[model samples]
Target chain A: MNFEEGKKQFIQTWGKLGSEWGINRTMAQVHALLLIAPKPLSTEEIMEELSISRGNANMNIRDLLGWNLVHKELVPGDRKEYFVAEKDIWEIAKRISRERKRREIEPVKSVLHQLQEVEGDRSKDEVKAFTDMMNQLGGFVDKMDKSVDIMLSSDQSWFFGMLLKLIK
Target chain B: MNFEEGKKQFIQTWGKLGSEWGINRTMAQVHALLLIAPKPLSTEEIMEELSISRGNANMNIRDLLGWNLVHKELVPGDRKEYFVAEKDIWEIAKRISRERKRREIEPVKSVLHQLQEVEGDRSKDEVKAFTDMMNQLGGFVDKMDKSVDIMLSSDQSWFFGMLLKLIK
Candidate 1:
């Protein structure tokens, strides 16, 4: 494939992948576009390239900035603000994991903890099953919480190296 | 919380978590209902308890079966099919990871590989940046693929034991 074709395919695939992982498609597409751009791009350029409406492009860019995956860049003489993605793939991964942990894992873990304390009759099979499942789920969520914490805090090479060794 | 309140909260939380991870709300809710159920649930029971239409419950149950997360059980004297979720938490995690790897990771990696082969002038900064990004993404995806494979193949206790140790 040529450069243009390759770039289109990448953005499309990235958008689909993002939607599957609970992100909006336009947001992921915006990120994909910025990821390969030679320099920071103005919002209008992003809208034109992606064939997205101004509002759609602007909303996603703002959300991306909130996630710390993208940043604002000011050109020396231009009045318009430009955006750039965090080009370091490892940093991108860490940011996403940290955000997901905070948004999904933390809330779920909190609920799981509360559910585990349900007042019930232990001898009853219904109560027994519910409590047991809560305990199991709570334990699993705790492990996941710890795992994300370690991933966020550790150096990329050292963390992946040890993980790869253990997996092997 | 009382048992009923706890059950309601758990289902709501699980459904929210599922939607955040790209699963539909009702499907996740159905799965949540099964997770804490003391006995295999009939379609009618599920619909009534969740206040969902019969079609909705049936569809999600079918999907859960497709994901290998739920199974249909036939009671000796009853003609109606009963459904049960895989009660083992570790097994559930492995199944989800495996499915996601097949659905998301494999396809993205394929596209990344194709994008990496884009014919371009190496001297062009745009081409150079795109190729470099694709290569970096490909490497990370490969590592993730291997990690999932290891998780799938290893015994639960052994895998978690080693992983927890490494994280510490």
Candidate 2:
């Protein structure tokens, strides 16, 4: 396949993957574009290459910046801001894992803790059984979250390999 | 916390986690409810507990079923379908892995393969680079998926322990 067609297909596929993971398509497409670019690209360049609206280009760039996946670049004697993505796939995975843990896991842990205090009919066997099970599940998630936290703290593959050993 | 407050917190947190991972809020809440229920719940019961519209409940329930995370149960002398989540959390995780592989990863891989055929100068370079990276990623995910499949297929803890040893 030719360069332009191949680039377009890559962007489309990456964008679809992003949407399935709960991110907007344009954001993923912009990331894909930045991933393959040889140098930092200006917003205008991104807009032209992706055939996206100015607002979309601007918004997604900001979101990527917030995720620490993309960054603003200053060009000598250039007025327009340029952007680039983190080139290392491993670093990208770390950032994603940290963000997910912070945004999703921690909050869920807090709620699960609160739920454990519910004084629902302790005398009733069913209610007791349900709460007991919920407690067990909550404890399980909490342990997993701790393991994820440990994994996120380092770039050590051996640590994860060890944890994987413990799963059974 | 009181029962009402605790339940509310649980639902809200579960919904937030779901959204971050690409599942909708209602779908996650329904799953969470099923996780804690002592018995299989009828659709009407789920609607009442969650205070969601019938259509919304039906749609999310169907999604959960498609993921194989929820099962339909036949009640004696009852026409209304009952639902229950797989009680094993590990099993639930394995099902999610398989479903996501089918629904998301496979499609992305197919497109990546197609993109490799695109011809052109810079575009070909871009396509080759993107497809190469995706292929590597696909392999990683495929291995982890296979591990999950094997883990769920039997009650053998020693094999899982061995796989975790490999990961570590």
Candidate 3:
């Protein structure tokens, strides 16, 4: 396949993958487009390239910025804002890992903590078992939370370098 | 709050969390229900509890079974097939991580592998940069794949035990 064809296929496939994981299709597609693009693209250019409505394009771009996946760039002497994705693959992975931990893991952990304090009679089997389950699950997630915290705070190259060695 | 109230809130909130991560709302809800239920639940019980249609309940339960999060229990003297979630949080988590690696990461890695083999003028800057990005991304994902494989093959407690120590 030609470069353009391969690029298009990649973007589409990536977007579908994103949707399966819970991200909106448009947002993933926009990120995919930015990933393959050789240079920064403007809102207008993004809309035109993706053949999406202005509102859809704008919203997804804003969300991308919120996730730290994309950033605004100023072309020399041009007032128009151009958007560029963090092209470093490692950085992309880091941003995603950190953001997801913040968005998904942290909130769930908070709820688990609260649920652990549920006022109840511990004598009854039903109540005892339920609370015990919650505590066990809570502890499991707590461990995972710590693991994610370590991952987010550490530098990728050194961390993964040592990790690959240890795991291997 | 009472056990019932807390359980209800937990299930709802957990389902929302799953949605953000790319699992559909209903499937997550079903899993949540099974998670909190003290005993195995039959199709009728699940449907009534969730107030969902039979098809919806069955489909989601089947999906949960597929994901290794839920299992069938054959009760003595009961013809109905009852389902119980893998209430052990560690096992549930391991299943999810392993399944996601197979479903999402592996496919993307394969595509990246193929894209790296794109036949083109290697001397051109465009071709070079694009291929380099793919390679870098592919390499990073491969490292992740290896990490996941290790996690899957090893005992959860031992793996997490060693990992927590290493990360610390």
Model 3 misplaced stretches (Cα beyond 4 Å):
A166-168, B166-168
Model 1, A1-168: lDDT tens digits are 999899999999999999999999999999999999989999999999999899998999999999999999998888999999999988999999999998789999999999999998989988999999999999999988887888888877886787688654
In candidate 2, how many Å is residue B30 off?
1.9
What root-mean-square deviation over C-alphas does model 1 reach?
1.2
| Alpha-carbon lDDT, every model | 0.92, 0.76, 0.84
Which one wins by lDDT: 2 or 3?
A: 3
Tens digits of lDDT, candidate 3, B30-105: 8888887778999999898889999999899888888999999999998999999888877787899989998888
Q: What's model 1's lDDT at B83?
A: 96
User: Order of all candidates by DockQ, from best down to worst?
Assistant: 1, 3, 2
* C-alpha positional error of residue A68 in candidate 2 after TM-score superposition, expressed in Å: 1.0
Interface DockQ of each model: 0.77, 0.46, 0.57
Chain A TM-score of prediction number 1: 0.97
Candidates 1 and 2 compared: the better one by TM-score is 1
Candidate 2 — which residues are off by over 4 angstroms?
Answer: A153-168, B113-168
Candidate 2 residues B45-82, lDDT tens each? 99999999999999999999999999999989999999
Interface Cα root-mean-square deviation for all models: 1.3, 4.4, 2.0
Question: DockQ of candidate 1?
Answer: 0.77
Candidate 1, residues B76-138, lDDT tens digits: the string is: 999999999999999999999999999899999998988989998989999999999999999
